[model samples]
Target: MVKYFHNGLDHYFREGDLNKVLSLCLHRFEEHGDLGTEFFIYIENAILKNKEYVLQNLKNMPSDFALRGVVEYGLGCIAASEFRLESTIEHLRNAFSLSMKVLDVFENEHGFCKSVVPFIAKEAYNLKPYDNLKDEEILLPKIKFSKIEKETDFFVLASCNGIYFDRYFEEFYETIRQHNENNIYHIHIANPTSQTEKLIAELDDPNFKFSFENTNRGASYFACMRLFIARRLMENYNCGCLVSDIDVRWIKSPSKIWAGLNKADFGWYPKPGPAPSLLVHAQIIAFSKTQKAFEILEKSNQFLAYKLSEFPSWCLDQSSLFRAVCLTPEAKTQDFRETLGDIETVQRLPDTSLTEKQAFRAFENIEISMNSDGYPILSRVD
Candidate 1:
C-alpha cells in the first residue's frame, strides 16, 4: 500500500504543473529577492493546487504522506521566510517526520530520491537549535580589528587540487599580489602528492601559508570543515579572513570587502538562486574576527555534525551557512555587491586541459589590468 501510494504521488508530480511551479518559486525567491507576503502566498497556492487530489488518492495509506508532506514542507519554508517561527517549526516537523517514514521504507529501492530525507532531516534538526538562540545573543555590534603595526591586516584562504596548481596558481598569485595591499594568503591543498608539497615548499614568500587536508569525503564535507579550520586559524589574530576558491581570479582588491566588515561579521556575494543552499556562492566569503563570527562558524559546524553522519550532496555547507545566518539573530552580513563592483571572476579557462606551459603561453600576450572605468579588463597586447 505504501509503495503504491508513493508511486502514485510520483506520477502526480511528474504529470502535474504543481512541481514545476513550486520549483519556479524556489528559484525566483532568491533570484529576484522578492520574499514579499504575496510571493509566499503564491508558493502556498501552488503547493495546494493539487494537494486535495493527492491527499484523496493517498487516503488511508498513511496520514500526511507524499504530496501532503511536501505541502507541509513548502508551507514551512514560507513560514521561515516570513519569520513566523512557530508555524515554521510545526510545519517542518510534520513534513520531515513524514519524509523519514517514507525513506525508511523506500530508501534502498532503486532510483529512489534518497537525498531528500537527509536534506529535510538536517533542516529540521538545525532549525531546532536556531529556535533556541535569543535575539540579543545572536545579533551583536560588529567588532573591528585594533590598529596593530603588523605587515598584513588580513589573509585570503583558498582550497584547490594540486593538479590545477600550475594551471592557475601563478596567475592567481600574481593577481593577489597586485591587489594584496599587504594582506597575506593561505592555500589549502586537498591531499597533495609528495611532488606537489615539494613544489609548494620551494616558494619563498613569507606572506603565504599552505596546508593540506583530507578531502576523501568530497568537496561538500571539505567546504564545511574549512570553516572550522579557518575559525581556529583566526583565533589568535585580530584580523579578518577571506575564504576563496583557487580557480577564481582576483580582479579587484579585497580591501573594499575587508572594509565591509566594519559593519558586519560576514560578507559575501549572493548568487541568484534558491534560499538556504543555492542562495550564495561560497567562492569568496569574508569573516571578521569576532565572537559573532566564531559563533556562526561553530553553529554551522554543529548543523553538519548532526547530519545523521550522512553527507547529502544538496549543498551541505552552503545550506549550513544559510542556517547559521538565520540562526544568528540580526546576523550582520554585507553583500559585496553593495560596495564593490561585480564580484564576478572568470572561474576557469575555456580549455581546462591546457598544460601549464600552454596556459602560460596563452596568457602571455594578454594583460589583466583595470580599464579607465575601474573594471578589470583582459585585452590582447600586440
Candidate 2:
C-alpha cells in the first residue's frame, strides 16, 4: 500500500461507499478484487453487515480432507464474524490464529480487492497487525503466530538488448549472494549490445545464472519472457520467475527487502514518479510462481500484460510487469512466496534525516560499484 494513497484502492476508499462495498462482497465472490479477495472482503463485510457469518461459522466447521482450503477458510469466516464476545472463545481463538497466519495474504491491500484474508481477520475477528491498526491494542494477547505460508521461490529474469546496465547487474548479483537461498534463485537474461561489450566483460566474479533470449522486441518483450519464465520455473524449478528491471538500485540491504517480501505471495514496489496515485513499478518484481507471490503478482500483472512497450524501452520495462502479475493463472499457485523468501534488492546507504523528493536521486551523484558475490544496483553498497 502507498504511504500517500491515490491509486486504485485510494479511489475506492474515497469515492465508493464503504458500507456498500462491504455488503456486495459479503453476498458475492465476484463483487470485490479477485476470487481470493472476494472471499476475504465478503467475510469482513459480512461481519460489518450482520455478524451472523462469524456466528454461523462457530456452529459448524470442516473435517480433515482436501478441498479448497481457501473455501474452507471462507466457511471459517462464519465463526470469525463473532470475534469480540467471550462466548465463542474457542472459535474466536481459531479465527484469530488461522487469519493471523494468512493475514498478510489479504490485509491492508490497495488498488484491488486483494486483501481477502487480512480484511476478514480485521472486521470479522477484529484482526490486523498492531502497526496496521488505527486503534492500538491494550491488554494485548500474545500472538505466537507461526509464519506466512511459503509460495514458490521466485527466480528473477533480467534481460537487456545489447548493453546491459552493468551497475544493475553487479547489484542484482550481489543481492543474490546476500539474500538468495535454496528457495530463491536469481537468473539474468540479457543480450548486451557491442558498445558495452568491453565493460560487460569487465564485470567479473561469477555466481550468476545467465540465459540467452532475443532482445529485439523492445521493453514489453521482457514482459512476455516473464510469463515464459514463470511457466518454465514453475515447471522445472517448482517456482515462479519474475521479470526484473536491472535499473532498480538497492536503497537498503536486499536481505531486509526479501524478508518483507517473503510475507506476501508476490512482490512489487511502486514507481518513484507521480501519478493519480502511487504507481507500482516493475523494476523489481517477482512472479507468484510459488503459491504466495501469485496473488500479489497476478494482481499487478493483470493490468500490465496488455499495455506493452508504453514507456522508455528499458525505463518503462517494469511499468507493465507489475500489471501482468495481477492476473490469475489456470493452476493454483503453490505457496512459495516466502518459501525461500524473496531474493530481492536492498540498498545499503547510510540512513539520513532529510528525505529526498526525487525518485532516482537517492543514487544520483553516486558511482555504481560492487562487492563480492555479484550484487544488483538495487542491493547494498559498500
Candidate 3:
C-alpha cells in the first residue's frame, strides 16, 4: 500500500487533481512567499505543453535563492522527458552546483527541503542521457553463492546497491548483530567495492558471510535476486530463509515466532488495512524449506522478469511478490507483532523533529493496539 505525507495541503490537492493543486500552490506562493512547490507544479505542467517557457522562467529565477536550484532540477527532469540530451546534462549540472549552495544554508533545517538535496545529488550522478544502451549494460552483475557447508537454522538475506550501502546497510548490520546474534546471516551484495569488503571484514562475525554480484541492476532486479537466492538456499540446503529490506531493524529476535509456524510454507505480513486488501508487505517475508514455497518463489521470479521486459517503469518486485502470494495456495498472512515481535522499519522523514526512534515507538504503539484487537492498522507519521 502507498502512503502520502500530508503537508497541510492534501485536502486542497485531493486525488492529485493537477488543477486544484496548482490553485493551492498559487495561493501558498502569494501568502507565504514560498514558490518552491508552485515552481515545481508549473515546470511539470510545462514539460509537454510549453518547454520553452519553462526554460525561460527557470533562467529568470534569482540565482541567489535556494529555490532556484530546485527549479533548475525540475528543468533537468523536463529536458530528460523530452530527450534533450545536451540540455538535460547542462541543467542537471547547474542544478547540482546550485543545490550545493542551498545545502550549505539549509543543512541543519528540518523538513522537505533538507531531505531532498541528497536525492538530487544521486539523480545528478546516475542520470544518463543515452537511450540505446545494450541489455548487458542494463543488466546487474552476475551473482554466485558460496557452497553451504553447514546446516543452519535460517538464512537472513538482504541486498543493496552503492547508494544504500553506507546509508542503510551499516546500521542494519549493527542492529542485527546486537539483537539477532544467534541467527545466521547471508548478505548478498551487488556491485561490491573494496570499501564494502573492508566493512564486511570489520563486522567480523563468524556467522555472517557475504557473496557478491558483479552487476548493479536497480532495486527491482535486486528484489528479484532476493527471491532467487531464498529459493536456491531452500532447494540446495533444506534451510528456511527470511528476506528483509536493509531499512528494517530487529528490536528483538523473531526466530521463535517463525519457528512456531511449522505448518506454513510461506508467511508474510499483509499491508496494514481492512481484510480482503490482502496486499502482502514484501519487505519482510519468510519461507520454509518446502516445495510449495519454492514453487511460489519460482513463479515470482518469472513474473518479475516478465514485468521488467513489458513495463519497466511500472514494474516493482513488491507488486510481483504480492501477485505471487495471491496465486500460491499455501501462502498465509502472519501478524507483524507475532512474527517480528518488536521490529521496526526506519524511514527518514523530511521533518527532523520526528526522530527515527520517535517514529519507531509510534509504530510500536499502533502495532500493540492492533495485535490486541486482531485488526490491521495503517498509519504514516511524517
Candidate 4:
C-alpha cells in the first residue's frame, strides 16, 4: 500500500494535480510517517476550510521536527483568520525564528529544504499586519449617485481627505484629461469636504462628472469605499473600471493601454521584486467587466472589511488585493507597466525638478520607477 501510494503521489505531483496531491498526502499521513508533508497539506486545506482544525493539528505536532516552524506559521495564519492580532504576531515571529534555525541546520542540504526558509520567511512577513491605527468605524455616507447623463468608456474611483483633495485633485484631473480627452471620466470621491465639492464644481468639464460621499477618516474606510465604487461601476454601468489612488498621475493616455489588456480580467503594475514575491499595487488597477474580475473585487471588499475590523492599517487594501489575486483562479492579471509605463512615486523621484515630460521619458527609456502609495508627497510631482 505504501508503494502504491508513493507511485500514485509521484504521478499526481508530476501531473500538477493539486486535488490529487492533497488527497494522497492526507491519505499517506493516515498511515503514519510523512508528518512534515502532512502538516503542509493539512494547513493548506485548513486555509480554505477549517482554520481551527489546523490550529489543533499544529499544537499536536512533535517538538523536535524542523518543520515545527511551519506549524507555528500555521498558528499565525489561524490567528489572523480569527482577528487575534497579538497572537498572530507572536506566532509569526516564532515561525520566522524557527524557520531561520531550520535553515541554518540545512545549510548544505539542497533541493526542498533549501527552498523552505524563503517561503516561510516571506509568508511570515506578509502575514504580519501593518501598523495599527486603532480606529474602526464606518465613516462613508449612505447616499448613492443616480445614473449619469453621459456615457463613459471607464471610471476612476478614489478616496481622500480634504488635505489630499486640495493638494492633488487639480493636477490629477488635468493630467488625466490631457492624456484622455476623448473618454468620459466618472471620478468618484469618497469622504469629500466642502473644499473638494467646490473644486469638483469649478472643474466642471462636461466630460468629467464628479460624485462624492462622506466617509470616516482612516485607511480602511478609503480602501473599502474604493471597493464599493468599483462594484457599483461594474454592476451598474457594465463597463471597465480603473481604480487609482489620488496621487497617481497618467503620464500617457490610459485608455489605449487599458484597451490593450484584452488577455487579462484585471491588470495592475506589480511592485518590483522576484516574480513569485511580486504583489500588485492597489493604487492603480484596471478591471474588465467580467464575472471573474467582479468576483475578485467582491471578495476583496469582504476581505478588506474583515482585516480593517481586526487591525486597521494603510496596507489593508493592497494586501487584500494580493490575497484576492492569489485565491481567484480565473482572475488573470497583467503587468500594466508593459502597456502604460511604470508608475512613479515621490519616494523614488525626490527631486522636484523632474518634470512630467522627464518622468515619461524615463519610463519610455526603461528606467526604474516606484509605484504609487498613499504618500502625499507623490501628489506634489508636477
Candidate 5:
C-alpha cells in the first residue's frame, strides 16, 4: 500500500486526480502519523507551477469535495505569494467555507505559501460558515494545558509581551484581583523579561496562575495566540472563559457576561462597521464550554497560525476571530452590545504610552461597581 501510494503521487497529482491524491495522502498521514514537509512541498509546488490545470480541476470538482477546498487553499497561498490580493481573498473564502478541515495539511507549509492578516480579513468579508459540517470532520491542533489546582466557575484569560510587564502588569493585576467576583485570573506571558518572571513567581497565588511561551514574536503574535491558550485552560478547568486584553479593567463581576453563554457558545461586543476589526472587538470575548465553541477557537488558532507566518500587523487577532466566526456559523454567538446597552461593565486603560502610574491615576477618585440592578455604573468618589 505504501509503495503504491509513493509511486502514484506524481501521476495522480499531475492528472488532477484529487480523490486519488487525497486518498494516498490521507493513507500516508494515517500510517506514518503525519504527511510531513516533503509531502506539503510537493502539493504546494504542484499548485503554484501547474496553477491552471490544478485550479481548473479543483474548481470543476463539487463544492462539497474536501480536496477542492484543500487545493483552493493552495491556490490562495500561490496568489498571496505573487501579491495577487483579490484572487487570494476569493480562493481563501471559498476554501474556508467549503472544507476548513482539509487545509490542516498546509498547516506546516509556511515556507511554500505566503499570507497576511489583511488578506485574511478581506477574505472573511461576507464569508459564510461551513454548512452542516460534522464535529468529527474538523481537525484541531492538540495543545496541552497545565492542571489548575482549584477550578473556578469562570476564568479571565489574557496575554502580554515582556516589554509591557512593569508598566502594565501591576495595575492590571490589582484591578482584576480587587474587582474580580470569584473569577480565576490566568495570564500567559510571551517572551517574559526577568522582572516579569520574578513578579509572577513572587505572587505565587493559585487563583493567579501564569503560563509562559519563550518566543520573541512581539505583542501582536502573543495576543493572537490567546484563544488557543484559553481553549486549553477551558479544557483544564472545565469552565467557561473570558479572554481579554491586558489593558482592560474589570468593574463588575464578569459573571454577567458568563451568564450570556447560556444563550450562545461565544459572546463579544461588535462595533458597528464593515471592517473586520470593527466587526468584533477583541478586548473582551466570552467562550462557553461547548464543542461548537471549541471548534471556533481551534479555527481561530488555525487562522492565526497561517496569518502570523507573514508577520502582518497588530490587529490580526481581531481579523482571525472574525474569520473563525465566519467559518463556524453553527457556533451560536451573542453580540453584547445589544443586551448590555451602553453600560460600562469594563473599561480599557490608557494607551500603551502611559505608565502604570498614569493609568491608575486616570481612574483615581472614580469608582465603578455593580449596582442593585446588576449593571456596572461609574460614580465619583467623595
Candidate 6:
C-alpha cells in the first residue's frame, strides 16, 4: 500500500483522484500510526469539505478537548475563509462563545494557541461575522471610481511577510481576485520575506513585490513597525490608497470602502471598544492624489521613521501610524472607518458546544478564580 501510494503521488494529483489519495493516507495512518500524515490528509479533506479536519480529529481526541479547541480554532479559520458562510450575529456569537472555551479553559495549551495566532488569524478571517452597508446603502449607485480625473488606480495593500503568510496565500489570493474582479482593486503585495516565497511565487505571483529594507535597527518592534509603515507609503504607486496590514483580512465585500474612498472626508474617530479604550489611527483611509492622502502617507512614513524614539518599541507600525494620524488633522479627523484589527479578535473556539467534561476542564485552566458556588471570575491577569 505504501509503495502504491508513493508511486501514485503524481497520479492522484494529475488524475484529480483526491479521494484515492486520501484513502491511501488513511491506510497509512492505520499502518504506521503517524499522526502527522493523518493530519496532512485530514487538513486537505477538511478544506475540500469546508469544515477543516481539525473538528473531526478533536471529536475523538484522546482526552484533550482544550487542545482540540486549539485545533478547532485553526480549522474554524480555514472553514471560515474557504466557505461563503452566512453573515449573521448568531454565527459570530457562536464562534466567540466557542473560542472562549478554547482560550479560557485550556491553560495547558496557552503557548500552543499563542504560537498559532498568525495562522489562526488567516483562517479566522474566513469564519466571522461580516457586516456591510445595508442594501439601501449598497444600492446607492456606487460612485464610479473614474470620476475624479485621478491618475491613480486603487491600491489594496497587504503585507504578508511572516511565517503563516504562505499558507494563507490561497485564501489571500482569493480575496485579491475578488477585489480585482470588481475592477475596484489592483492588489499589490509588500511581503518583504518569508520561507515559502518559492511556492508563493509559483502561486499567481503578486502583481508587485518588494524586498525588505533592513534598517540595521535590531528586532525592536518600534523600529520594525516604523520601517513597515514607511515602506508601505514610500512604496505605494497609486495616487489613492486602501491599505491594511495582512492580519485583518476582509471578511465581507470591501466594495463599500472602495466607494467610500470617493466620498470620504478622511477624518478619524475614537473607535473605542468594550475591551479597552485604546486609541487607534485611521487604518483605512482614502483620498485622491489632489487630496492630502499622498502628503499624509509620505509625511507620516518619514515622521514615524524618525520618531521611532517617541513610541514604545512594542506598539509597532500601527502605533507609529496612529501617532502620525494624531498630528495631521487630515488624517486624525477622518470619519472613515476601516475594519482593521477586527480579524485578530475573532471568536472561533466552541466553548458552549463543549461537553460537560470539556467545560469543566476549561474551568481548570481558566486562571480566574471561581466563587465557592463555582461561578468563574475574571481576573486582571492574562
Cα lDDT of model 2 by residue, 1-382, tens digit: 2212213323333444444434433333323424344333343344345544342542333332111233344444333222222222233334434444443444443412223222222222211111222232211112122222355444445554444444445655565555444344434344655644555467553433444454445544543455434544455556545555555445443444444455444555543322101133444554444544544444333333332322112222343332233233332322222343332324322233223333223323222221232111121123
The residue-by-residue lDDT of candidate 4 on 1-382, one tens digit each, is 5456656644654465646755665565456545343444445445545544344545665666566677786776666554454675567667656655555444453322433344444444444444532343333345355566656667666666666677777777777777646665656666667887788768757766556665554644655576756766566665788777776566656666666466588888665431111356666778888889887886666656555554443345665666677668667777677766666621122233445435223222111111232111111112
Tens digits of lDDT, candidate 5, 285-374: 888889998988887766566555533344667766766776687789887766665425555554555553352243344333322432
Residue-pair clashes, model 3 = 4
lDDT winner: 5
- Give lDDT tens digits, candidate 6, residues 1-382: 4445555533554455555655654565456544232343344344444442333443333333323333343344333332223322123333333444545433344332332222222222212221321211101111112222224445554443344355454555565455554333332233335555575567653344433332323323312342344333433444445554343344444555555444442433233321000133333444444444545555445544443333222223433334344445544233444432342232111222344334223323223322333222332223
Q: Rate the local accuracy (lDDT) of all candidates.
A: 0.54, 0.37, 0.53, 0.57, 0.60, 0.37
lDDT for residue 378 in candidate 4, whole number 0-100? 12
The reply for model 1, stretches above 4 Å from the true place, is 1-151, 160-171, 202-204, 214-216, 312-314, 345-382
State the lDDT of candidate 1 residue by residue for 107-167, as single tens digits: 3432222234333444454344333322322211122322334655567777666665545
Q: Candidate 6: what lDDT? A: 0.37
| Candidate 2 vs candidate 3, TM-score winner | 3
> Which residue runs of candidate 6 sit more than 4 Å off their true CA positions?
1-152, 179-194, 205-210, 214-236, 265-271, 274-277, 281-287, 306-312, 330-333, 337-382
What TM-score, to 2 decimals, does candidate 3 have?
0.51
| Model with the higher lDDT, candidate 2 or 3 | 3
Number of residue pairs clashing in candidate 1, backbone atoms closer than 3 angstroms, sequence gap of 3 or more or interchain: 0
Candidate 5: list runs displaced more than 4 Å: 1-146, 149-151, 351-382
Ranking by TM-score: 1, 4, 5, 3, 6, 2
- TM-score for all predictions? 0.58, 0.37, 0.51, 0.55, 0.55, 0.39
Candidate 4 vs. true structure, TM-score: 0.55
Which candidate leads the pack in TM-score? 1
Candidates 1 and 4, the one with greater TM-score: 1
Candidate 1 displacement at residue 370 in angstroms: 53
